[model samples]
Target: MSRKLLIDIHTHLYLPRYAQLLRARSQIPRITTLNGEERLVILAGEAATGRPVGPSYWDRDAKLRFMDTHGIAISIVSPANPWLDFLPPAPALQTCEALNSDLEEYCATSPEVELGGRRRKRLYGMGYLPVVPGQEVGGVCAAVEALGKLPHIKGVILGTQGLGKGLDDPALLPMWESIAKAGLVVFLHPHYGMPPEVWGAQENGHVLPLALGFPFETTTAVARLILTGILDKLPALKLLLAHSGGALPVLSSRLASCIAHDPVAASRLAHDARYYLGRMWYDAVAYGPEELAFVVPTRGTDRLLCGTDHPFFPPLKGEEMWMSVTENLDAVENAPGWSEGEKEGVRGGNAVELFGL
Candidate 1:
């Protein structure tokens, strides 16, 4: 049997300029040396959470090699979390332009990798814009306009916090309008999880933050967007939710029940909470067949896209093949109640159609 065409829609890369900028800073999102190795510190309470930084996070050759080894035909790469979120508007705008340009160059020039005996691997760029706190709406729109003109840029990846107001603020109307007008898809990812206070004083590593907080952050942000009628207002906007809509699909019924019990919350949207679940696209990063099974019913298979967070979720067993990547593939391939054609769609067909890859 021939191998299926695979496209990874959720991978990330930090261009050299962005990495250098982080290396020179002293703040939380900065890079610091620990035991002669560069490590990325991205949160305020990151004293014990920083991961070792390496070439895979920013090198083009390293990314292509990984794609070849994994049989990924095309990878849509984007700037990872907390992306220019900490910078002031002027430098943030300039940094965004440089970062997008660098990403565009890599996607346009990356060598074709041999996959399944066919040299078919390629990379596509997802540009960044100056969406940060305290920036003037007009300045952010200017950045959006610049990104739209970049030929190789297919879309953008954004942190849950939209201009630090958490995506529900009316101040974001202009930026959303600009991206919608540009025909760019929004890859909504989570960077800032729930408050540290919610985690308590457990020294349990990243399980709490990664397993619980991250999904809740995305769930809350999207809920805010839905309740504020922003999703309804922007009908043409396309959003791809990271981490399988981040607990939103599973917890949707509970949210809808709560809204029903309260007139104020129920009055916020013209439609029910369940409507938004069907409105957005979801990535198959949930890690198990049963999880994908549940997600299929919530959003349908046509909306599913495959992703391997790469470089972020490395194999801990020192194996060349990442369990993070293979496990998700296994889940999608074996997910119950999905037809063969639907399985192929979840793997890469949806991404190809959604991003024009």
Candidate 2:
């Protein structure tokens, strides 16, 4: 029997140079040493209990080993959240250009993989952009143009916010047009969850913010884009939503109903809010088969791709395979009503076609 192709499209890694930049900062999203171990403190209230940072984040060898252990053949890595969102326009553009170059080199230099009958680079990348507030459209568009020239960059990862005002901001139209013209996918990820108070004063670690807040953040961003006609204006834009499209698949019907009741919103969209769901892609990182199965009906099997949010949700203890990886793998393999070929596509074939990998 032939080996099943497994490509992870949602992995994350910070290049060493980028890590050093974080280390130099003293605020949230900085990397600091706590009791002799480097810890990455990104989200709000994480400074006291930041996650450990090590080779798994930046070491090429460590990434390869993790991939091998999890049966992932190829990984499309991007910088984790808070990407260029903090920097001023000038510094943001400079850092975006340099980091994108490093990202291209990082993937371009990785060892090749033998799959089917061909040898291809084992790694690929999702580039970053200077999407910070006050960043001129020219700079953002320029980054998009430069990314088009990078052979290994298949897409660009983005946070929910766009130029400070959220994705619906009109200022991002030029950047959107440039990305679509360049034929690159947008991997929409959530960084800033809801306000800190929404989680209350309880110390629940990252459970509420990550599990609940992240999904809703993505849900709100995409909903605004749809209602505001971003999709209608740029039908060619290829967007891949992370975390199984957050809460989109489940809430799309609700969104459509709400739009139906609101005359203003009803006239705003070109189609039913749910219809746009078909126009976008989603990753199978829901951590459960049912949630994975739920998204397929919204867009069918073709739009679903497998992903592992590697190096973030690593095992709680030593050397064990990550549940985050295994759960997603099982979800794709066992999603109800899917044929063997469909499962294979979600496993890797879909990504191969989507990003031209």
Candidate 3:
């Protein structure tokens, strides 16, 4: 593949239907007009200081335009954070079905691009699930089966919280099995950060939650999944961790040591803790080349797919190109040990092979 065939695997959008669902809510995860501008209030204490949202959050045309500007040929889009987890089991399942249908339609009807002397869709998607607690595994499996039938929906975006418990919950084993059986990748993302008191009593904007909380949440969740031997049982499961495995690569050694010291924990896994990092996939969204380089040893070059968490970290100064996107692109380009072919793999080739794009 040419270097120009850049594929972004972590882009996001909220469908109009999902947006309307949020707008109808009277709680934290709702949209409301503040001082004549619409803001999305998803996190705790963000009701008054929610961030502004607009067409970029839902418009397909806007997404294509952004892709064109950034030289992205294809994007694997998913619904953004705080997904249907807060709703009741019935509403959550219903909402997820509707949103999944909308996402399929969104990708199926997108404009085509010329690639490899043929026309193909410029967009694909990762669907959502009603993985709430008390929701039947049968229902979730049925949803997974439905996603498998959609040509454009290649994977499912899941949060760290599984069935209202964390990923380590044995209750989610059937959920993992069904997803694996459908051959859909699980793009594990983080939404609930650490407890608020850790950041101190004073207001700190979103800096602490975004920078520290999100990644830590991912790290802990994934660690629990690994330590509890979920990956050991579900060997066929394909997990693509957001934010470059969220410090897992950096902390795997320490975790291994701790597990080694504890006989009960060490006996649970078939292999060492670090070995599972290679088994999982990661996106190059860590912003620094050094971070990407550090991750490659544990998560090999082929497992590292390029991504941009777009529509979240847009240019603050109204610049045309997003720094968040470029920073990740640059990281993959300049990652110390990567050769040209390896860089190409990280940029788009890996995603093409992983998602069968």
- Please list the C-alpha lDDT of all candidates, in the order they appear: 0.84, 0.90, 0.90
User: For each predicted model, how many residue pairs clash, with residues at least 3 apart or on different chains?
Assistant: 0, 0, 0
> TM-scores for all candidates?
0.94, 0.97, 0.98
Q: Model 1: runs farther than 4 Å from truth?
A: 1-3, 112-121
Q: Which tens-of-lDDT digit does each residue in 177-216 have in candidate 3?
A: 9999999999999998889899998988999998989999
What does candidate 2 score on TM?
0.97
Clashing pairs in 2: none
Candidate 3 colliding pairs: none
Candidate 1 TM-score to native: 0.94
The order by descending lDDT is 3, 2, 1
The collision pairs in model 1 are none
In terms of TM-score, which candidate is stronger, 1 or 2?
A: 2
Tens digits of lDDT, candidate 1, 325-351? 999999998898788998888888788
